[model samples]
Target: MPFKTYLINKTNNRKFRLDGVLRSRRLPAKHKLCQKFRQHMVLRTDQLPPKVDLRPDMTPIEDQSQIGSCTANCLAGAYEYLTKKSNGMNMDVSRLFIYYNARIKGNY
Candidate 1:
């Protein structure tokens, strides 16, 4: 079957209207990075230093095994960094929780 038909059937099983949900959501405007790049006539390669490590202070590298949870893992890492910077607390957000939530929301 076609992708659209598959999506329609899946949404129907969940008693959800994909069209209505999509229509209700507002599309995001152009990203700030895109806007900044658009205004420049030529790319500025010299502005940034040769070796810049912008890694957060307390954020540690994470490894997500065989499962398809890279996005969730990255989000958890970012959350950990933000929380640590905002307050001096080193809290570990569960990647599994994020992954499960995203999966349930039909985003995975």
Candidate 2:
């Protein structure tokens, strides 16, 4: 079944379509993150440093080339970043290897 949704503004009424919006299933309670792991910061602008940028320390962008392996690419980037920041090594991680093991670990 298809349904129509409308959005109205005080000044002008506009028609909008929301049928293509996607809804995801909520994660099970057991899978939810612990309260300690979740951070909810409340701070004024002056409380923090004026600027913090880490792009210069990141590895060069890796090309996925139309592969549906974003999970692998993301993990590889983070791993490379940690290695570079900690050991001062700019080694590149293999997305193919990560994707392969990720599929196995995830049972995909």
lDDT, candidates in the order shown? 0.72, 0.83
- Pairs in steric clash, model 2: none
Q: Which ten residues in a row have the lowest lDDT in candidate 1?
A: 16-25
Give the residue spans of candidate 1 off by over 4 A: 1-56
User: For every candidate structure, what is the RMSD over all alpha carbons to the true structure, in angstroms?
Assistant: 10.4, 17.0
Q: Compute the lDDT of residue 34 as modeled in candidate 2.
A: 30
Predicted candidate 1 versus true structure: per-residue lDDT over 2-86, tens digit per residue: 2232233564565433343233244457565343334537647897568856565567777788987999998998889878887
Model 2 lowest lDDT segment of ten? 31-40
> Among these predicted structures, which one has the highest TM-score?
2
Alpha-carbon runs more than 4 Å astray in model 2: 1-47
